[model samples]
Target: LEKAGIEIDRKVLADIASADPTAFKAIADKARAALA
Candidate 1:
């Protein structure tokens, strides 16, 4: 996950942590696939 362009920086991590898990996972999944 970190290997991709996704940034696990403080802000992004906080947003993801506070966000709905399912929704966040879905978005992350799509983004990872797109990157692939």
Candidate 2:
């Protein structure tokens, strides 16, 4: 997805985490610390 022209916000990813943490971790692990 990164290779494409796509982007995701930290909070949006965190919201996904609220539902399925594992998926969130996989998607936004790069921004985990900031999101916290």
Candidate 3:
């Protein structure tokens, strides 16, 4: 998040972390894109 200059809510992150594999992968990809 710091690297991307982005901040996500803790609850949102927790939800993402607990999401299904596909959902988690999508969110992770978005984060990577932000960093890129």
TM-score, prediction 1:
0.49
lDDT of 2 by residue, 1-36 (tens): 343322766677678879888877666655554455
Off by over 4 Å in 1: 1-17
Candidate 2, TM-score vs. the true structure? 0.42
The best candidate by lDDT is 3
- Per-residue lDDT, model 2, residue 12, is 76
Off by over 4 Å in 3: 1-19
- Candidate 2: which stretches are off by over 4 Å? 1-6, 29-36
Superposed Cα RMSD, model 2:
6.3
Candidate 2: residue pairs that collide: none
- lDDT of model 3, residue 36: 80
Q: Rank by lDDT, highest first.
A: 3, 1, 2
Q: For candidate 2, what is the lDDT?
A: 0.63
Q: What TM-score fits each model?
A: 0.49, 0.42, 0.51
Provide the RMSD of all predictions against the true structure, rounded to 1 decimal: 3.7, 6.3, 2.8
